[model samples]
Target: MEFQLDKINPTKAIDLYRGMLKPRVIENKMLTLLRQGKISKWFSGIGQEAIAAGVMQNLNNDEYVLPMHRNLGVFTSREIPLYRLFEQWQGKANGFTKGRDRSFHFGTQEYHVVGMISHLGPQLGVADGIALAHKLRNEKKLTAVFTGEGGTSEGDFHEALNVASVWQLPVLFCVENNGYGLSTPTNEQYNCENIADRGVGYGMESHIIDGNNVVEVFTKMKEITESVRENPRPILIEFKTFRRRGHEEASGTKYVPEDLMAYWEKRDPIENYEKALMDADLLTKDDQKKFTDEFNEEIKTHLKKANNAPPIESSIEKELADVYQNFEPKNLPASTETNHIRFVDAISEALKMAMQKNHNLVIMGQDVADYGGVFKITEGFVDEFGKERVRNTPICESAIVSAAMGLSINKMKAVVEMQFGDFVSSGFNPIVNYLAKIHYRWNQNADVVVRMPCGAGVGAGPFHSQTNEAWFTKTPGLKVVYPAFADDAKGLLISAIEDPNPVMFFEHKALYRSQRSDVPTNYYTTELGKANLLKEGSQISLITFGAGVHWALDVLENNPDLSVDLIDLRSLSPLDTEAILSSVRKTGKALILQEDTSFGGVASDISALISKHCFESLDGPVETVTSLPTPVPFAGQLEDQFLAKSRLEKALIDLANY
Candidate 1:
């Protein structure tokens, strides 16, 4: 598996350059169309066409590839239709994304091109997950991820590389280092002379190549890519080139220094490669003219076909149809068959069970495997499932989440663990933009669950302790679930895993080892978009969720005269409007309490919904109580005051009076 650069045929190099030039012509024509207001925006992969096309040429059509926005050159090399590229640019129905995504956002599962994600480095992690799944299933394939030098600045890029390195994943990270991230040069991004040096710190094989040298790129990358597929490992390929176009259609060249622009313009990949082919005697002036003429005609034909295609129907039906494909109720063993266990243990057991059922299930993230998770929830499962299935990922949060999104889209269930809920924010882009929105947008399901340990009061610092339920609850097409008791935890988790849409499963660290409850002794299941009435009373309805439910229960038990109806909002997104209205009708009063901040919180949403639907039934104003608008204090006295918990009996009496 040794690479011989000198052995590359001159004729093949000429052919490769010819292939690269077509995309550049397409980019130039599209830029003209963009200026005419025929296209909304365009991110040209102009000067780096050689690297994009060369690396892509080595990729098999059956293998997966995740591209960034400026990857039309690479995508064209992989046989993506030129007309569809124009249709995408025009935001037409026949576009690559079915008119749902912008020109830069596209996908084709049939060709194993996972997606063209607009969000920076997040897609790299997804590429890693897809590769890991292929390795586990013994599905002989490779995943190639192409990104920009600017993407390396994102935390996700580090996360993805670390996971791929630790797991020996079959993924090739191709960084198209085109001198500048828009107008900012590489010198401003890092102190290192080359972007490839970062790979050394991640324990990955690294290579630096002349991006404009199509021959060298094709020859050098072929063996490295082959080696990765043969024995699943990761490699980082840094292609040093320069961009000849502005960042996007609206951005002008004013910010770019005249000298730098002139220097890169002279070294443009399209023109330089054309000259190289003529020098090598593989192509004559007549041959170049004939090829160029044929390519322009090809582009015109595709554009005509793409523009004539009918638009994709944008409706609510589109959202309903792809939530789950072939969704049948899964056969589960009766609850009586399994022994009684703690909530955290049940969650671990569910992971084990799901992995055994579906070979596509992959568990990854920081300390999830041999360490059994920071809370010891996944104990001993790594030994049973092996390191491949139960993987211990690096401390890269963005990569872990993005990789999970990629795996999910490719029909693998990626159950990733975030060491803490606070770190989940690091992977927010992929979670919200790709994983969550993809289902509703292009009728694609990113079936992934990001397991986060949340809540507070267990002595974790302000950094470690925080709840982000509201953050995800507002996002469309995403499911958010929290468990109260041991049985609910297991049932909810199983349901979350079975769900077609992406879900954020929030597990309270405080509840993991606090106290055990009596779970069901027989078969039981939890439904998505439903709530539970923990207690039934008539005085007032107390709407709460997560750790706040426990706080509500304690107050009700202490006060006999309160007669409060308490509801546990298990699923936050598709709120149980019927149950909410029914309880509010009987009680004629309500109160929404939570441990998170009162401003722009879940409580506010509940109040808004209630005000619209149950305003006529209200005896007085709906009381909403929540934590103070500040960070969770470390001091016990300060925490108690900041927390939304009311003093034992008196608060319940006060609520009943209202």
Candidate 2:
């Protein structure tokens, strides 16, 4: 595209010049502060302001924007006060994250901009989720997201684009190819001549544009945005540009050749745009000087005020207060009529009840649609509720959860089912960083539930079976529930869906069909953070959750002569410490058990907590009975030795003697 100055109105040209200058001046001012050691670090989009101006200028106020670290011009274009930016860098409470997160990592619903987590690929999936939500709700707004050439190397880029294409989502992907990923040249990054070439593989309309020419970007973006608004589709645009400065204010670009730097310097976005506007008489010298002065003065004044802002709080108590969500829920009343159903059937019934109650509820994951999921937990959900709500996602664990995060925040609720509990490792970043902390960081509810089918005992091997509740137990703002009974599975899921928090609901794989009980047919809400006592005794207290609960019950059933109080810990994160301490005090002994490996697992944490709280009540040392630290072996003999009932019985005998 050629530089077409006459195509844009004079008034619009002046606005574009002002928008381009805002980031240029502020970044320049921050560089001086960086050199003085007043600021720690800064990422500048120095020579690529034109692409930002063009892309942002055409966006509808309601559409969502997921910006990269270099897209600070988005904040400027949205009219976010310059003081807030300065306050954020200064770590003040007035910042979007309340001094919690730094740099370009804060967003507000009012601005329709999502604050990005440090990971690049997850946000692309989140953007796709936002676009999906808009489409499902029939909202006219589209979604615009920014990425770099280096980001295209990540798998999430392909995953996000593929899903958006299949769904025909209204998303605009702005890929800014600035020639270098850190110090590595574009030639070393990818084999393709243009980044846009990859878009064809995903079935998207992608194009390469002259990023230095603001008019070109503006015209192309406006046309594409207009068409997307009328008939939604994902579009990928590669803005070929450069960075005059290095990676950051402090990191020198020594790898950049001297000649290449000189070449891009001649085409600086702001400098060239300013001259073009002056030549066309679209912007007067007085207006240009005033705009420059305003940016300069704003930066200097806000920087001083930000420096004088209140210092960060050092209290651990206040910090803890920001960790979990505290909300008043409208609990659904229970029904007395009962029906016999299996554990898997009860979960499906729970989903039906939840979706029927709330129309906005959706279930998303791998093969959950026609395939009915690997466990057949949600086999008929799609036939009941259309495919829009019951989606069969690609084999993208991170994308599924990350997109669910986006969907849940925008007046929609999502239940993401991980195909296997062991696969949660791939999606750990979204679960911990974005989903768990969003509410604590900005007081916004991350209303989503992750249904993790966990535990071993059925010979599903290590990768197919795992009890991952302990891993997420330490994450703040995450609720971990591992239900062992049928009634609790249905009741707790209803409660989890209604509760405005990110909950990791672990359904035991062995219990899905092996356990069947007369669960009530009507909807009910079982309170979270409460323990279930199957049987009461005073000799020794047996504390466990998930498949361990079933094993503990069996141990008690077999040893009728032995006395022990069996406690099923439904919620692992917000542990029922009161019940645990009371039972241990009465019994004067504690035995914690789990199918998890011995090292750094749930059993170890329970042992530590009991030792710290009720040391005087102990007649014998608290023992943690867990499987050996080995991968769940393939051979039946190895698995039998790994999770033998004899081991639990032996530990019981040892505790009884003590």
Candidate number with greatest lDDT = 2
| Per-residue C-alpha lDDT of model 2 across residues 1-658, encoded as one tens digit per residue | 2458878887887778787889989888888888889888899899999988999999977788999889888989998888888888777877877778888987788788887777788888888888889999998889998998988888878888988898888989889999888888899999989989988898899989889889888988989999998899999889999977777766788889999999999988877877777777776789888888988888878877888888866578878777767777667766888888899999999998898999988899899999899999888888889899999988888888888987875678999999998998888888898889887677667889999997777788879867767779878889998888899999999999998899999998889999998898998988889998878998999998877887877777888988998999998877899999999999999999888888998888889989999999899999988887888776778887887344898798799889
Instruction: Please write out the lDDT profile of model 1 over residues 1-658, one tens digit for every residue.
Output: 1223345686666668777878877877888888888767787777877787788878888888888877776677777777776777666766655566686676777667766566677788888878877877787688899888998887778878888888788889999898778878788987897889988898988999888777778878888887777777899989888777788857767877889889888877767767766666767889888888888899889888977877656667764655434355565544555555777776776677677776778888788888898988788887888887787776777777777777776678878899999998877888887787776455667778889898778778687878889999888778899877777777777777877778899888888877466665444457766889999998898888878888888877767677778999888876787888899999998888878887999889889889999889998788888888899888888878778884424555676775
lDDT of 1 at 105: 71
How many collisions between residues are there in candidate 1? 3
- Angstrom error of the Cα, residue 90, model 1: value is 2.0
Clashes of each: 3, 0
Q: List the residue pairs that clash in candidate 1.
A: 125-403, 126-402, 126-403
